[model samples]
Target chain A: MSEAALLVESLAYEYPDGNLALHDVSLRIERGERVALLGPNGSGKTTLVKHLNGILAGNSGSVSVDGVRVDLQNKDSLRRIRSSVGVVFQDPDDQLFMPTVREDVAFGPFNMGARGEELDLVVKDALERVGMWELRDRPPHHLSFGQRRRVAVATVLSMSPKILVLDEPSSNLDPASRRELADILRGLDITLLMVTHDLPYALELCERSLVLAGGHVVADSRTREILRDTDLLSRHRLELPLGFRVD
Target chain B: MIRPNEDPLKHPISDHHHGHDFGERLVLHRHSIVHHLEPQVKILAMFLFIIVCVATPIHFWQAFVVYGLLVLGTILIAQLPLNVVARRSLIELPFVFFAIMMPIFGSGERVEVLGVSLSRLGIESGASILVKGTFGVLCAVCLSATTPAREILRGLERLRLPNLLVQIVSFMIRYVNVVSDEMARMKIARLSRGFEAQGVRSWRFLANVAGALFIRSYERGERVYLAMLSRGYSGKLPDTGHGSAGIRQWAQGLLLPVLALLVLAMTNIWMSR
Candidate 1:
């Protein structure tokens, strides 16, 4: 196989208050792979994804993205790394921060110094990708929650990152919106690490799954294998949705 | 596990339409002259008037009257309901009123007024202060009611107000109501639990609530900042170009206020001499 897009060696993190968030984690993601980080509440799924973009420094282990080590010494490299890895935060309210949808989408490109027509093109393209081109003028506060979430995705997509990290991509989406998100995710060619509790969604979009429990990766295997293992899921405090049956 | 359909936190204050007529609340008619002026003109005029009012000595009673007439004329010309301005001004008046009362309690010459012995110097200084503060507050209320908050920030931006300050104010204006709504819901929850602050120990609960609110706000701010950064928000704010207070609008807006202030100043000068 080609070189891994991201490689983590014994990654660990502990909060200043002495709460261990992640412990001795090692994972490797190949280019263009779609993986789901599955865990119950407080499982350090978010902490691991944050390290992918250099947003948070790992306490012990090193994280390298496509051979570039994410470290504090290279401020310019960190910006470039963050730009290369688009993180769509779980909360739309947290992701869609601009007054208008168009501006919010334009923000990432603009920060990377894209200006004038180039920036406009990026904004329009990204908004169109999420089917939010028409709502470009509407304030995010006025949009439905699902629409806002789509705009949040557009905000990062405009940056054209090589890796897309989505936290709880389907948490608050309605059926129609979730389907739309799935379609969008399936169409994208970039490597993706989606952290979510939605088991069915993971099965539909991600081929591989990493199960985290108490800040440790308890199980990592093919998505179908992990889902079929009822005993492993119970140990990790994850349950299949009611009426969900795998034949 | 709570089914997706049955998340209690999703609908904390369920049925927002139950009693509140949000549509009616939003469609308030503010016909005040300040409202009609282009936002930029109103912002500039208000700023200038506030500066003059604040800088003028308390003993400059005539200047205060001119400022009052200018404000009152703007209110009448804008055709905004007087009751709205009066009601909104109350929020600001209490603080000034409290400050104005200090001179009354301080040592001063004794005098009789309405069969009560009061300090003559105290009343004089206090009355002057009351007049200065009232006109200032009225001007602010009229300006706010006339210009929508977003447009006000835009106007400030056009007036060359620091972008950071205007952006901060814009964010506050947009989010303060949201934060307040959250606090109100929290208060309702606390009330439903029969929690009441009775003593120092009870204040600990209040402190905890405050701490929780602060943490929530801080986390929200981080998310907001990240969102902003994601959207190409560098250090500078975007130029939306909605605030266009041109020369004609500026002329129309300033004419009456300037004329009134001029007439008042002349009358005051004549009276003083």
Candidate 2:
């Protein structure tokens, strides 16, 4: 059988302050799956996502990307896991730290030892994918928020990871930009784990969804069914937009 | 002077959108030989020019004239807007103020002009400082106007600047706007809640705002670090592998400095004669 794209087994994490952020969390995502991670404020969703690529190591249990275990002690394993599981941060300002869009997109592949024409092509392809090729030379600060968001996605996409984990991909975007981003995400064929509070967005993009609250997996089911279940959502402090009906 | 309706914090972004000239501050985004030259080459040449200007004696007024001509010639060649260069060079105003005070306060042989007595030696020294300072400021303005900030940092990197320092400056350039935007938002939030600064009493509140900004920035630094690690950044900054300056490019860039040096040599020789 093919290995799962992302696997977490009995994971638990605690902050440096000794506060438990996650406990006994486990899930397996098959290849080419689009999964939405849903939760309210401070519900360990970010904690779980951080563990996926060893950004935050849990006190117990494990995370494996494409059957390769995330080992903080092993530098090579960490590097491999990092490149395999691309994490696009919530703030484009955080992700696109490089001066120019092209350089920001090239940063990941360049770190991976891609150089010369190969590096140029990688940057070009990534920028083109996001329709930001023409603005590659523009500084990140000069771009509009939506354009910056697209470039942020390109920054990770250039790495061509096995699994792409996005933190609130649709947050703070205007309607047209939202639709455009949705179209771009839909066009790509890869494993996606999106952490979002945008219920309608989840329902539109993801088939399966995982709900975490109070440091545990409160619900794991299909996105449509989960959204339809008001009792299950309200219990975990999830709310859909007013007058929004699930068709 | 902020307008009553205008928040000073919101000025930068709006200024950016309204005028492309204000987007990158000193950078003019022009296409000229000066702009096209390699950054390190430009850096070295400008450095040489400034050094030669500074080394010249104040009595070499003819040399100063030539230097002024050279600067004017460069501005013409670079097609840089004269008003922009003049405005940016206003950064040297403090020195100008000091120079103005020199003739009045300095102790030397007295001279009278327009019913006022001033030290002759002080006048000469003050003029010297003003001339040299103006040239220095103008040269710097020219360089910055031609080259973008990122290229300047890259040039510094290629010139073997410490990677950590270069990275710090790089992050500063990238995040200055973001940080300022955050500060602006915080100020707006405060103002919306009817907070007003009325004197010494407001100093404490402003200090609190600064403290909050510091904490926010610190947290952002951590998040940015994690984001860096997530992208395979392991201590070493990845080299972008931009090509270095060739001999022809170097020769082209050095022409201005070489000419200025020759002018200095001639001025010294003439003075000795």
Candidate 3:
């Protein structure tokens, strides 16, 4: 827990269409910090997290997970990064692609060569964490959107990741499910970096938050401070709910 | 199920349907005899049984009768609806049509029946095709009807089918409905904007929809790949380590094939004698 769990140094990325999705972005997240990435649409939040797990190699600069550099060119390094950092994408439909929820959760640990009771325990524990143990046998398609979202989180949790990188984890969930999910995340012990538009959620869960806009880290400070800054919030096209108070 | 909004009619796009469920197709009717058997054993047994029925000589029409009865017995044990058996066999309709024309097109020894003369060899071939086709289709339908698609994929994995093919099929079963649901939503979106499928102009609009769907699906494929990659996926999906079947389960699965093989062996010997 002493080491910086995730380190992004001077990262920059541009899409194939020549649009810069990330520009000189850099941040350090220590182990056990639940940091929220706050940004408007097209502000490169997704692009930034994709770089953390080596899914999208940056054009310049680097990302390191627990002291090991994330390089897609190196097979061993990429695998190490993937096992250490699990990216929970916005859409559960995309993440939970396996035929059954059990298999989907088993996928990560299974890939890491876990088997038999060990593998079973990993899947069971992960599902139990998200309150989805009963639905393990059910197909991901058969699950409702909220249920699918929870199962999607379990899919990564099964990997026993040191860091959970979620991209818009609360996008399509109902209000109750969203609250339940926030509670679930709060109870977990691992380091969490969640990208979300849910401002109140950010304040409720994360202590420190990073705001990215126009492919750069505009602000990195306390979640409450960022929310209270009406000037910064309005500049980024971010809005708090009507009559909602941070107090 | 908390209603996300007070007025259900005015919901956001986030309320989009996650699944279409593909309707009643893969539903498991519980407590059936065939459902109790392991999927891998059932798969191999059905394949071998179909082969045995197909390999029996056309000269011995009685063997076809016996094979049909065996399939019927298995269907009865499965508790599947009789109409389902018949309706699912519509897959063989084109083959049946071809078999129907066999007597008219081919030249062979002649035989008279009901004021019309047909070639004896052609009639024999047609009957053989019909019997073989029906038995094969019946066996496949039974296997699928008894086992869910997910179990079948697991069974395929156990059978040592190519890993890549198994994965392709597994994903297809999972996402076939999701893709179709996306298409349905796209149709609704267009319809809501005053678009209607009329005569000539509809094709271009439909083509554009297909193009857009292709792009969206391509993007989704990238995301799914990323998800897989994030979960430590290498070139191959690691071994499941859970497909081990017990001896009794194997025996139960193999019972059908062993019986069919016995029938075929007896018929082959009797025909030669």
Candidate 4:
């Protein structure tokens, strides 16, 4: 059988200060599946996402992206995992560090050893996908928050990763920009794992939702079903918008 | 002041509407020949021109005049406004002040000009400093006016500047605005809580703010590093190919410096005769 797009088994992590951030967090995302990771602040969503790209190696268990295991000690495996699992950070400012948007988008593919026409095409395609091709030459500081977010997505998308993980993609966006980003994400064919506190956003974007609380997978079910479970959401500290009906 | 019904994050109180001005202040985007020249050539030409200006003696005032004229002519050709050049040259005001003080305080042979006593040697040396310093500043301003900051960094890289230093400078340029914006937001938050800095008594609060800004910036650096790693950045940054200058382009770019050199040579010949 073909491997799952991402597989995390009994993964656990602890910070340098001995703070146990995640424990026994096992999950599997099939290819092309859109999954929302719902949890309160400090519930280990970011930790899990970091493990997917081998940014933070788990103390125990294992993480595999596109069937390749994430091994921090193995440089080749780490590179392969990073390219296969693109993580779009919450702050665009952190991700888009290049002087111009075009160069920033090309940074990833260039590191992957792409050059000349191949690099140009990858940059062009990524920007076009995010509707940022017109503003390709502008600096990141000049772009609006929504525009920067889209460019941030493109920076990862340029690598053509098998799975795209977004942390708080809908945060700090206006209504129109929020809808626009949703449309863009919906159009993409890659597997997605969005870590968000925006419950409505999760319901709109993902078919499945995983609820994590106190370093554990408390719930994993359909997004609508999870949203409908008010008791479970309150228990996990996940709150929807006031008067947001799940019917 | 928070607007009603508007998302405060969406419309930051310290909105950077003039953020583009930070870059545009130095680089005037235009289709002029000077702006089109390769950045390395422009950088080299500016360095050569400054070197020649420094080498020329103060006695060669005519040569200085010609050098100034050459700069003015290039500014005209580059379509840069005379006022902008003059405004940027105001950065030399402190040096100008020091030069003026030289004539007043020097202990050399005294001379009187319009009821004012000045040392002859001090007058000559002061004039030299004024002329040389002005020429250096003008050349630098002209180079920056024609080339974008990114291009200047690329030029430095091509000129064999150490990769680590270049990356450090590049990151500094990119994050200066971000760090400043973060500070501005923090200030607004403080103001909203009715906090105000009132002289020495407020130093504690201000120091706390500074400390907070430092921590935020440090954390931001870590996140940026992680982002770089995610994109496959190893110890070294990848090279973005920049086309080298052709012979003709080099000749065109070096014209100003070469002309300055000729002016110096002619001044020497005339003085010898």
Off by over 4 Å in 3: B1-24, B198-202
Of 1 and 4, the candidate ahead on DockQ is: 4
Taking all chains together, the TM-score of candidate 1 against the true structure is 0.79
* Cα lDDT, all candidates: 0.76, 0.87, 0.85, 0.89
For model 3, the docking class works out as: high
DockQ of each: 0.30, 0.83, 0.80, 0.78
TM-scores, all candidates, are: 0.79, 0.94, 0.91, 0.94
| Native contacts kept (model 2) | 0.92
Candidate 4 lDDT by residue in tens digits, A108-153: 9998889999999999999999999999999898899999999999
- Candidate 3, residues B22-75: lDDT per residue as tens digits? 422544476876887778888988988887777778887777778778899999
**Candidate 3: share of reference interface contacts reproduced:** 0.92
- Per-residue error for A165 in candidate 4, Å, reads 0.7
lDDT of 1 by residue, B115-186 (tens): 867777777667766776787778776766566556666777888898889878767655554565676788
In model 1, the clashing pairs are A107-B231, A107-B232, A108-B231, A108-B232, B31-B78, B31-B79, B31-B80, B32-B78, B32-B80, B33-B78
Root-mean-square deviation of Cα positions for candidate 3 versus the true structure, in angstroms: 6.1
lDDT of 2 by residue, B2-69 (tens): 23443324435445343333326667777888889999898898898889888888898898899999
Regions of candidate 2 where Cα sits further than 4 Å from its true position: B1-23, B113-115
